[model samples]
Target: MRRLIKLGLGSLLLLALIWVPTSSTEATAQSQVSEIPNVYRGCWFQPEILKYRVRMTATTFTFGGGYYEQKHWQPIKQQTYRLSDQVTAGTFTWSRSTNTQGYHTIKVRGGAYHVKVSQGTLFVKQIRQGHDINGYELTFNQISHAAQVLSGDVH
Candidate 1:
């Protein structure tokens, strides 16, 4: 199943992120879980069309975790949401001056095709089961054991 593969790759990626570089086994045993990470990490997928047998990859780190989400989709009859709709979120450490923590910019796509992106605490995506649905159901998908690009002093 495609979901299985996606979940596996996401797990590997997280493990590699937590993996510490060491000169020996002893050094490997002394790594901390909250070390400063040095890269941008994200997850993506088009679950709606996975049955079509399309191979799409957003990010790949490794393979292996347990993450499950319950999803729901409802259709709106007369839509009025726009692409310009956006919401600023704060999911990670922040710089009081730059204000770029969490997601700096979230773009919405899909209200016309059953997928509408709105803003709240995080990037919100709604899915529907009809054409030109006015409203939609939504579920949040998150990759577990991930790190963020920290700006403030880590200590």
Candidate 2:
């Protein structure tokens, strides 16, 4: 009878374990929602020229799009990649460039780039060998549908 009771308790314990979700699952779900502020969530692009674009969501950051080359703006395919880590609240410093500093930041492409939003603009810069690359910095303004239509950006 003692052995039978132990087996029953073991089976009950196994069932309980199967029914309960582990903390890791909860953490992953929570982490999927980005830490970037809501004000920074949107698609941003250069004003006069569509040289580059960046889109931010509750869980993802996408960078790429129309690029300037050969002395003209060219439309390029955008690629989506995951942020290397959760965005944390704090300033990210890199060589004192104005666009390289912000109140919050996230890593991208295996820490190849640092992204930040400040004063309604999104800034992205590529990092190599622990330093920011010059001329590789990108600044984008939030896209406004109404403003774009009024500005003749949208037809």
Candidate 3:
């Protein structure tokens, strides 16, 4: 009787410990979402053009593309950009300058390039090889059509 009571109490205590952490983690996640900038958080990449979709999330940002060249989706190399809290509004551009000789290469990169973001509009300009790429202006609306595609809401 006493042993049974102790066992039940121990089980309840263990359950409470687990439940507390889980609930706390969930609450913390919810709070972060509220604080996060209202931006697209999902897999996005351009398929028609060689230019890949740049993705940003709470923890990381990645730019890459997939090609179905040989009957398989092959993932291209991606560049990761780190974000700082100081970044308030602007377009972030990224580029790499590489010097290659005989299959050896060195890469120099820049990113989080400031542009401007207003009213949920992201305007991006392209820079290639230390020169601005001509006639290339990329824009993304905050309410993306990509989400519909991802959710199978689009045909």
Candidate 4:
């Protein structure tokens, strides 16, 4: 009779362990959207005022012109830009132009470019140009969600 009682207790403990994770996971998934609000709600890039800068480079290229964003051409002003780890250091070139009338084109090198931003997620495109090889694009995302998992904010 003692052996049977022990077996029943073990079974209950096992069930509890299994059920805890499944229920917590559901709760975590439901709360993820509420954590970040309207992160992807607008036109991410404003080409008219292309504010940007580069660091740890020999030379700097400024975009003193107008560009296109969402079918409109607007003036671009130079500003300081920050780069994440995803941006590789090397020869990089970027151009901005509108796909409509009154378009503007601006190009720059020796700096990083902002590729995409969505759902509180940001991506920086890195470029490396060489002989017989032009360049390549690399995308990066935030891993802070992993920290939330450790803190019990996510399961």
Candidate 5:
């Protein structure tokens, strides 16, 4: 009887150990829209891709290309303007049930883009036809806002 009781307690402990990680991971993976209300609504420019700039609003995403000079980014015309909808309410998670990175998906123009926010930085990846293509990732930092202000691209 004592051995059976010990085995039961061990099984209970194992179950608890298994349960704790899953719950916390799910919570982390399921990011709320409120957590990133205005983080994405601005213009983004990358130095590596100096000829291009991206702008985001509450309901639209725009991509344009031009040149950067004297701490300013100039876009001659909006190349691709797409109506975008934010996937709120934790609608999607990529890879593995235990994954803990939270991101937002902007569906537009026959594909989607994933925007991940970490420490006030935006990491964006473009997915075309359900596959993540190479050389289609962007990283935005504090300098992006400075450039936006300088270029008058604030929204």
Candidate 6:
């Protein structure tokens, strides 16, 4: 009878050892989107201003990804326009069930914008400010590759 009891207890401990780690790992992965939003990294471009690159991550929005390591937008025809003195960051909330739809907001020192992105396509709904352009409906598409920065005006 004692042997039977000990065997049962050992089996329960073994089950707990296996179950705890598995559950914790699952929980961490599922909550990663909410905890850290800066996982989306890529180069995006606007049609009117194709020369300037917008590199967006889950955390920060870099206006001139190529021209300047700093944040600014340099159009092909226009001069270098500052986005913010400080770095501009972004945040998006994703649901556990859906990855197709999400809300993205970017707040820079000079400008702020809110967008809704679906399937890698961003629809700009509110453009509070921009270095050159302001308050317009715009859509940014993800480019297949990154662009090279040809010229820049250093601060």
Question: Of the candidates shown, which would achieve the greatest lDDT relative to the real structure?
Answer: 5
What is the per-residue lDDT of model 4 for residues 20-88, given as tens digits with 9 covering 90 to 100? 999999888644322112332222221123322211121222222344344333445534222221223
Instruction: Give one digit per residue, the lDDT tens place, for model 5 in 16-66.
Output: 999999998877654432222466767665545344566666545666567
| Cα TM-score of candidate 2 | 0.58
lDDT of each: 0.27, 0.58, 0.46, 0.36, 0.59, 0.49
- Tell me which of candidates 3 and 6 scores higher on TM-score: 6
TM-score for candidate 3: 0.38
* Whole-structure CA lDDT of model 6: 0.49
Candidate 2 local lDDT, 1-155, one digit each (tens): 99999999999999889767676677786565545557667877865554566766655566666754433434577655543333343222121232324524454434456666667777777666667775566777865563444345567
For model 5, what is the alpha-carbon lDDT of residue 140? 65
Order of models, best TM-score first: 2, 5, 6, 3, 4, 1
Q: Which candidate number has the best TM-score?
A: 2
Better candidate by TM-score, 1 or 2:
2
TM-score, predicted candidate 6 vs. hidden true structure: 0.39
Q: Write one digit per residue (lDDT tens) for candidate 1, span 32-85.
A: 112112222233222232211111122112111212222212222322221121
Better of 2 and 4 by TM-score: 2
Identify the runs in model 5 with alpha carbons over 4 angstroms from their true place. Answer: 1-36, 49-51, 69-73, 76-100, 142-155
TM-score of each: 0.17, 0.58, 0.38, 0.24, 0.50, 0.39
What value of lDDT does candidate 4 attain over all alpha carbons?
0.36
TM-score of 1: 0.17
- List pairs with backbone clashes in candidate 6: 37-58, 38-58, 38-59
Against the true structure, candidate 2 has what lDDT? 0.58
Cα error, residue 26 of model 3, in Å, equals 29
